[model samples]
Target: MPVGEEVREAWRADLDPKIQAVRRLARRYGARLLAADGMFAALSATARPEHWSADGVHLTPAGHAALAAAWLRLVA
Candidate 1:
């Protein structure tokens, strides 16, 4: 989990600015951005062991289902 946390820290450091830029552009253009990364981060916060595969990075079936549900909630 520590490794996952480290990776998330690095990922946010690199991506948060880019996501912010995209958010600005989306706001300007009246467009939408579906940020799956943020969705996954939220899921990971409450993740069960079955949520991840052996590799940890990849999602298991249950995880994929959960993510899909989250996406639907965002879009719906």
Candidate 2:
């Protein structure tokens, strides 16, 4: 199963660096990445195993498409 938010919350001190890496990727791509308290809260509440694979990780093709669409909407 994907690690639940409860467990993730317990390890946030460790997880932050990894999340920062995502921010770094956004910078490398010249993408605007905005992190907010509400974004984290919503993600914690709505993140699902279905978002990924049997290993409960990585974006599926549809996930990539959705991300692309969101970026398009923001940029356009």
Global lDDT scores for all candidate models = 0.70, 0.59
lDDT of 2 by residue, 1-76 (tens): 5667676576676767878888899999987775532343454356654553223345566555655666677678
Enumerate clash totals for all models, in the order shown: 0, 0
TM-score of 1: 0.56
Off by over 4 Å in 1: 1-4, 48-58, 73-76
Per-residue error for 61 in candidate 2, Å, reads 1.0
Q: Per-residue alpha-carbon lDDT of model 1 for 3-71, expressed as tens digits?
A: 476775886798889989998998999886677666665766787543644345677787678767877
Q: TM-score, each model?
A: 0.56, 0.41
Candidate 2: the clashing residue pairs are: none
